[model samples]
Target: MDLNYYDTLIAVADDCPVNGAVVPALRGGKKTVAVVQFDMISADPGGLTQEDVLFETWLRRRESDGLSESERAELRAQFFSRSQACLRASPLPKKYGWGLRFDAAGRVTLCPMGSDEYEEIIAGEVPGVNVLKAMRSKRA
Candidate 1:
């Protein structure tokens, strides 16, 4: 995977409805927004060579389907901006690999950075630190 691809993925994920928007309250009644930003310039393609082009094409197609060029451009700009905001707002850990982890109670947990479901899980209103275990166990 290319680093640029990863960054683009993250950016796109940030703008997704599942990722949503987060508004953190700061001191003095102020609000702060954090969004995700991708640095595609530094990405290095490791194995999948066509990934970046494919993703770009998808975006272009979606933008061009039924809207004028200006409208499409505006939508794309908004999407990218929102994606950056979401990235800045969230604190996603660096992904190392893909696998499952088990808790002491023998519950299953999946830590996948590439999963589209990640944002939904994180945005869900659930209590308890072991929610992931419950979630995965339920899926099982």
Candidate 2:
């Protein structure tokens, strides 16, 4: 399938054949767990976009490291637009055992595979909810 900039639900094998592995905290991975944890810990349940999660984490941890305001802003923009690629490439559903649930406002939250919640959304049981699997490890 042709994955658009914001495409949802590109399926991947449960086990990655290329690496023959499932990395819980894959180095340089999308930090899937971190993204989910951030939402779970936040005051609002589904308020942040995928870009918001990445930028907030970056700002909190590395804001003072070296990047200037303009550069930081640019980087955050890259996460959302103009750079290319979509959240289908994110590791949350690719390697980690989770599914992505995009709400009506396009903000997303993690729904682990086979869970009651995940299945509920996948079964078309949630209103204004978009469910998409992560990109697969190998070509279809």
Candidate 3:
């Protein structure tokens, strides 16, 4: 995980939809975006970029995609910008009704939108923290 991917100030979005965008292409099938992201974030407290998760997912689907380490690194670098466009746009915040929160250490954790913690955080009642909602798909 990279520190660049960590944000001390978290994004908490409510009223979002569950859009299955980051799901891995698997042999039997794919898991939901929430399942993938949660597992990835949980594995490392440092947090990961959308690309990190996506790359892992892609590898899960095709380990023999055939790219050298250098090539893979280059592709991953390019993937950052590309992934940014998809990450915040993820269904985790866009539709799954989960709030993404970062600790002082910059690790991310999910808060169900229906949870009291989400309400307190969203209301700014939580001390020493900031939250931003996910962007809506269309005009409100």
Candidate 4:
């Protein structure tokens, strides 16, 4: 169960409303999945793999109070043991107008839509990088 992409850029969805990447805001007093994902990537661009991002997002939201280090590790193992959706379903690309670039090592970085880097990737100027669009928000 590996959830990593290499030398790839996940472009924004076709129905994305923004012209450029917009930082996701907290929902009420809580962090949304989009916010968590954005923060993690923003804090360490190209440092986290897709599995890291997804698991952290789940962990941050879970009530893990009083859990020991080994307990947390076990929980993490259980989390990834099940099927998980990839970043293509993530709101960063599907709604927030950001792109996800996975490097050769499968570490992810953000590419804001409408940015020069994003344009280069979309235009195939970034050699060896394949482009994939985020999943659509609505059915046809």
Candidate that would win on lDDT:
4
* Model 2 Cα lDDT, one tens digit per residue, 88-110: 66555566555655554656555
lDDT of 1 by residue, 53-139 (tens): 233333543545667778756765655544232121222221222212222333223334445544444454322322221112112
Candidate 4, 8-49: lDDT as tens digits = 999999999888889999889889999989999999998999
The candidate, 1 or 2, that scores higher on lDDT is 2
Worst 10 residues of 3 by lDDT: 19-28
**Which regions of candidate 4 deviate over 4 angstroms?**
65-67
lDDT of each: 0.30, 0.53, 0.57, 0.92
lDDT of 4: 0.92
Better lDDT candidate (3, 4): 4
lDDT of residue 60 for candidate 1: 49
**Candidate 4 local lDDT, residue 35:** 91
The collision pairs in model 4 are none
Q: Which residue segments of model 1 deviate by more than 4 Å?
A: 1-3, 6-64, 84-140
Error of 2 at 100 (Å): 1.6
List the candidates ranked by TM-score, beginning with the highest.
4, 3, 2, 1
Question: Ten residues in a row with the worst lDDT in model 4?
Answer: 59-68
| Greater-lDDT candidate between 2 and 3 | 3
Ranking by lDDT: 4, 3, 2, 1
Per-residue error for 20 in candidate 2, Å, reads 17
Clashes in model 3: which pairs? 16-95, 17-94, 17-95, 18-95
Q: What would the TM-score be for candidate 2 when compared with the true structure?
A: 0.57
Model 2 residue 81 lDDT score:
59
The Cα error of candidate 1 at residue 76, in Å, is: 0.4
